[model samples]
Target: MSHGWSIARRLFLAHALFILVLAAFVGTASFVDARDRGYSETADRMLAVATAIADNPLVLEASRGADPSGSLQPYALRVAADADLDFITIMDTDRTRWTHPTTSEIGKEYIGAVGPALAGEPLTEVSTGTLGPSVRAVVPVTDEQGAVRALVAVGVTTSNVTIALNARLPAVLGLALALLAAGSIATWLLGRYLRRVTLGWGPEQLAQLFVYLDSVLHSVREGLVLVDPRGELVLYNDQAARLLGIPPRSPAGAAAGGAPLLADLDLPASLGELLQSGRPARDEIHPTGSRVLVVSQQPALASAAGRGKPAAMGSVATIRDHTDLQSLGNELQGMRTLSDALRAQTHEHSNRLHVLVSLMELGRIPEALEFATRDLELSQQLTDELVTSVDEPVIGALLMGKAAQAHELGIALTVEASGSLSDSGLLVQDLVTVLGNLMDNALDAAVSGEAPRTVDLRVSSTADALVIEVADSGPGVAAEAEEDVFRPGFSTKDPGAYGRGLGLALVRQTVARLGGSLVIGRHQGAVFTVTIPTHRSPEPTPAADQAQAPRA
Candidate 1:
């Protein structure tokens, strides 16, 4: 908003002023040189005319005769007219004029210097005489014995010299004008180029914009990255460096020359590929190392007010950490799974009570009692088995809740857990995250599959490692999509389905964080296996198997 004089306009004005001053200086110097040369030429010509007249034999004879002006006056007039001289004077050494351009002054004392001529030296100077200021020359005539006899003075007036200098003025002025025009044109072209590059912004405006942008990049909560059209990493802020697990750049590294290339960055495959493709993405989720990030990208462009349409400058991407958010979402999902299971159980218990009350009223107490006993035994068996198996109560509760949920949905879920996982050298939250997501995926798969829907879960902790496997009776992942299943935002379900692809991505991230490996294989259904190395050794225990019967 701080509008100021544009660089183009400023440069144009400055250069134009410079050209004007230069032209004035050059023109003045040229005019002065021409005037001086004109005066010098005039003086030289006057000196030649004066010396020629003094050397004339007719002049000597006329001057020596009784009547000097009788012949000299006509002769002086003829020579002055022929030589373009302003005036001619014939005088004696006593400063008495014999002949003159003005005939009235004839035989009068000369109005100008005659001593130099009497001394027998030819003298040339600019002097004010009866005819006005002129470049004049005076020379003396000598006899055969070298005694001075007479004098001749010849000059061209200052007016005539000025006229001659003016005659050459057009050429000098024309050359100066041509140089000034050339300079102006060149300045205009340079100004135009500067305008295009700077987008007509002044230096101060550009500097202010840069300062604001730099502050935003550093102060904003989200990570920001800028890539050039050639896939080079042109800029990245501190948050971006931290999220991407790269070294932070120095302050001076904000410059393009100091920034690293995209290929040189140790980025996750999905993110690296996305940046390299220069594709626009909105709120995309990606997993890198132990962290999950939500990223958005768009193509950057330069203004189109120049020579052509807007051009692709590069791409700008923003990143926000999603790891904590994903963890919280997983916890909420676990709670929802437990809530659904409780609701189903409550519904079943209420139905059973209604049946019992109806039977009692109909006097069929034995059948009601038998049904109740069988239901209690089945529920009690599952609870006892899980309690004996999973040492971590949180994990046990999660598995139990999932089993109950599956039973209500008419899917048989079997869980086999062995060896104490309490000493598995993994955080309880991490363990729950890994197992909960896998079970959720399994249950969802089984519930949507063909008749006799079933899911199998196996968890075992050894002296060196902990392993978990979940197999579901559903359509397995496609061979082509096997690698993509773990990528964020990839799903076998409808693309528009809410929260479709994030579950498996979180599972993969957790497993990797625990330094585990997950393998996908097919038997009657899809089987997912995870193995995480551990340094702790736990006491061996008999395997416990708990199975939930499908609802009848």
Candidate 2:
């Protein structure tokens, strides 16, 4: 839905209205005050002139003459003309006008109030007379004995007062318009600034964008967390809170001040360090309690314009749960190993059958029987040894499969099992990950060596623990490189291949998860030994493992 006015337009209109109203109020007040002042000043000036005319000795003597108008009227007219006054009236104590602006009004009764003047007091007021409404003043003309013998009144018309007020109106209006113009310019500039900040987006658009961002954050399966440069959490989606074991009741910005929520949750130390580092990192696998999480981190940076260095704002991290996927991959690898073993056995039997048929066709019955007996005895003996040495079917099958694979590669492989294995506290997947990787590494090294390449495998279990050791007649590991051999991504093999060095790393991880240990033995060839505790309580079966195993 759209509103007729955008936020910027609304702001501008509101500001302009406020400024206009203020200007109008100030202009009206100034005009009214100036008008009142003009009237008062005009009245005072006329009063001063009236008092001066009434005090003159010549006017006083003339006022007491047998014809007061004949002597005083001329003098009053001359004084009024010089002072720019509309009228000047000289009247007796009887209130008869002796002089007026018009000759016809001479000797007539004054048409305006003279009560104060008759009482010997000077006064100023706005009054209407024969002439018109005027601002007028009245003063008494006293005799030698201080008696009021006559009166003089001076007045200026209301039109003259209005003219004086109009003279000052332009200044007031100009000031008011100037103020309004300044306010409008300021409002326009402010509106432009707001437009830049909002990137021209209206209120409706911004609100819709917020809604979309919120939906995306909530719907994503991978956990995402954002932290500020100070190592305080800024944003955490529902998935992140659940994955990190944080309570859902925590409010936003609650962690911004101080990350009490992060402190309460069981996060790995490496992850906590990454959040605090304010640096970019990628694909770091961390183990948090029972879950394995692959986490990637990116730092937020400010614009690099002109500045020598970019400013670090914060960091964002995404976490993915890899436990289930890793389990499935291990199972698939085990199935492939079993299939390769079956293929090797089939090929071996087919070749022997071809030889036996040739011998029978040549009519060599004794030679055919001897060849068949020798092949059957050798295969049966190896099978019986493996079954007797390893009581667990999974381990027996794995050994048999690896032995056949070794034979196909023309590498002599030997298995020496000194003790029995129980399946009570052992996981077949963990066993395959450990034993399969070690044997595969040994086979690779054995095949790459000179003639007479051989690999030795040993398995023994005490009442407390199970131990396995594998050694190959290949180039031994350097003393300095032995520790780094098990580190993930550290490979001496084909450098072009990705995930080549992860086999030993996965083996080490599995060993650590099961509370076991792996070490390199001091021998002529690369010898790896793994020991796992058997007396402890069994580890819980993973949900993925409980599903159908991978088919061979």
- For each candidate in turn, the TM-score is 0.74, 0.65
lDDT of 1 by residue, 1-552 (tens): 235988888998899889988988998898999888888888888889899899999988887889888889889999999998889998877878888888788878887777778988999888998889889999999999999999999998898888888899998899789879988999999898888878998989888888888888889999998888888777888999899888877446666376677788888888998887778999888888888898999998786365667788889999999888877887888889899989999998999899989989999999989989999998899898877778988899888888888988899888888887888778888888889888888887887788789999899998888999999998877788888888788876775564678778888888887788999999777899999997784444544222343445
Worst lDDT 10-window in candidate 2: 248-257
Report the C-alpha lDDT of model 2 over 249-282, residue by residue, as the tens digit.
2343453455644454567666677767856877
Evaluate all candidate structures by whole-model CA lDDT and list the values in order: 0.86, 0.81
Q: Model 1 segments beyond 4 Å from truth? A: 1-15, 36-83, 87-131, 135-155, 175-220, 224-263, 272-279, 299-316, 355-374, 447-452, 535-552
Residue pairs in candidate 1 whose N, alpha carbon or C atoms collide under 3 angstroms: none
By lDDT, who's the top model here?
1
Question: What's the C-alpha lDDT at position 429 in model 2?
Answer: 72
TM for candidate 1 is: 0.74
Listing every candidate in turn, what is its Cα RMSD in Å to the true structure after a full C-alpha superposition? Answer: 8.2, 8.4
Which candidate gets the maximum TM-score versus the true structure? 1
